[model samples]
Target: MKTTFVSLALFLAVVAQMVASMAVITNPVSSTKGKGGKKLSVVWNDDGKSPKISDWGGVNVFLAVGSQNVQYKLQQLGSNLPVTQTKGSWKVDPSIGANSKSYFIRMEGTKLGSDGNPPMAFSARFELSNMSGQFNSTVQNAANGKEGAAPSSSTTGSSGSSSTSSASSSSTSSTGLSGAASSSKSSSASSSSSTTSGVAPIYLNSALVTVGAIAAGVAAFV
Candidate 1:
């Protein structure tokens, strides 16, 4: 009888653990300041998934910052194809509270024909963005999954280009958290640098958010 009771308790405990693991915590995430007084940076994991940059024809990505309308473009490599503009515009605003940015993407390409010529296919464009911290966090938890015994991170593999993890300082404030939150640019810079080795980091000077891409059949001018 004791053995059976122990077995039942173990089963119940396992079930409780599983439920807790699935619980969603959408509580307001208090932003934190960086160790230094520098601004927060943003990073992108563009290399791992979905229509990777290398898969398409010549591709260029750019970001537009501030009122000066200053823009910087990431150079394109790979196959040579015509630069075609796609429909619609991709825009995002990082200044808004949690997740307030959208993403814009374009693709282009051509294939060699049997006649020793080249055949081209129309380019494709994709744009996606999401707000709502609860929704975004839920999706992220689902997609990222549990690292150890913890719950998942996110569901939507693509959480827009602006979504980034933050680094916090040890110093605490009256809020019982770190000091003032770092700027988004600092977070972006850290993310981009860590993800891309041997590559220069890009700085975002203003609040504006714009990313441009150009391929054989698809091109986005931000």
Candidate 2:
């Protein structure tokens, strides 16, 4: 009976620790300054660098404010060039050139064809505003099962013959907790399932916890 009691106590303690760890992993806080001098606090997964894909299917990421378009090429501004392949919180600062009232960002993912040409397979757009203190990205929101508009191509005047894509299909705007919260949750789950190396630590930790629980139960019975 004494052994059983000790085993049960150990099991409970392990369970408590597992719960605490999960809570910390799922909720992360980050803060960044907007170009307009506003401070924004965001909760994200902090999954490290953006993903890289095949050169044939390379992705283009950009931020636009009015006529100014800022392009981020892999490893530029902390993006790992191939952002379309990874599923996690990828940090990006949308500021480019002078401060602006609003920012529009987009991602274009392409796939190479048999004819040696690449065509767009996926595209997304996001809009950020200083007044709202929140950002709304079409792909991020849609991954959480929310309905939004699709991305479209646009031309920027300031960026000399550079074409910019915008995702302005949805009429609705999202608030902080509503849009971003869903994004974090969905992205974390996706990251855990999609890539083996990306979420290896999280999976290992969870497995250890589960194994410990099973051992404790078996020991109690013995």
Candidate 3:
């Protein structure tokens, strides 16, 4: 019985360690539109073991239309410059020209440092033209070890130029933890989902913790 107790204690300890490790990593999600209007969506793990400051990364998005280039920088909701938080989004302002033929969209992700500053992580670029009306694009961060999928839309343009009508108004809003912007466009939407490799789900970690607690209680009784 003493030998069994020892083995059980060892198992519980191992399980506890595993559970703690599994709760640190997180996946990245993003979405963008650039035809009739411009919008962005970003999502990250808000509640993970890793330092809360480094949970989400900052983002910078650029839209180039004809000879004009517009830049939108998205940081943590309430954090100061170099914003790197769990989630945020952006919407382009002044709107891209309706007569624009070709355009480019660029996205860059920056990981947070120990001091809560942003450091370059990964980047992606897309060239679009002759857009039908609207388009949606999705990308995953490089943390997943696999190249993310490219942006795809339902409408097709001609001569690398989109003929969509002028976009509507633009509005921006942000809470303490998350943010979002609004724009107007019409087209099919697309989405992409990525998972951090070698990381288990949060529920699994909770289950392991519970099992470890039960094991420890039983060991006490023994």
Q: Which tens-of-lDDT digit does each residue in 74-162 have in candidate 3?
A: 12222332434444455534222222222233222345333222222111222322332221110012112122221211110100111
> Over 4 Å off in model 2, which ranges?
1-60, 65-102, 109-117, 121-126, 129-222
Give lDDT tens digits, candidate 1, residues 1-222: 011111333333322322222111111111211111122222112222323323334422222111101111111212243233222222332221133221111122333222221211111112222321111222223112211111111111111121122223222111111111212222333332111111111221122211222232111121
- Model 2: per-residue Cα lDDT at residue 57: 51
RMSD to native for every prediction? 22.0, 21.3, 20.4
Off by over 4 Å in 1: 1-195, 210-222
- Candidate 3 regions with alpha-carbon error over 4 angstroms: 1-33, 45-84, 94-118, 126-222
How many angstroms is residue 175 displaced in model 3 relative to the true structure, after the best TM-score fit? 24
TM value for model 1: 0.16
lDDT of 3 at 200: 11
Preferred candidate (lDDT higher): 1 or 3: 3
| Candidate 2: tens digits of C-alpha lDDT, residues 1-222 | 011111333334433323322111111111123333333222212122112234325543333222111121111121234533433334443221222222333223344333222221111112333331222343333222232121222211100112223332322221111011111112333232211011100000111121111121110000
Better of 1 and 2 by TM-score: 2
The lDDT values for all models are 0.20, 0.23, 0.23
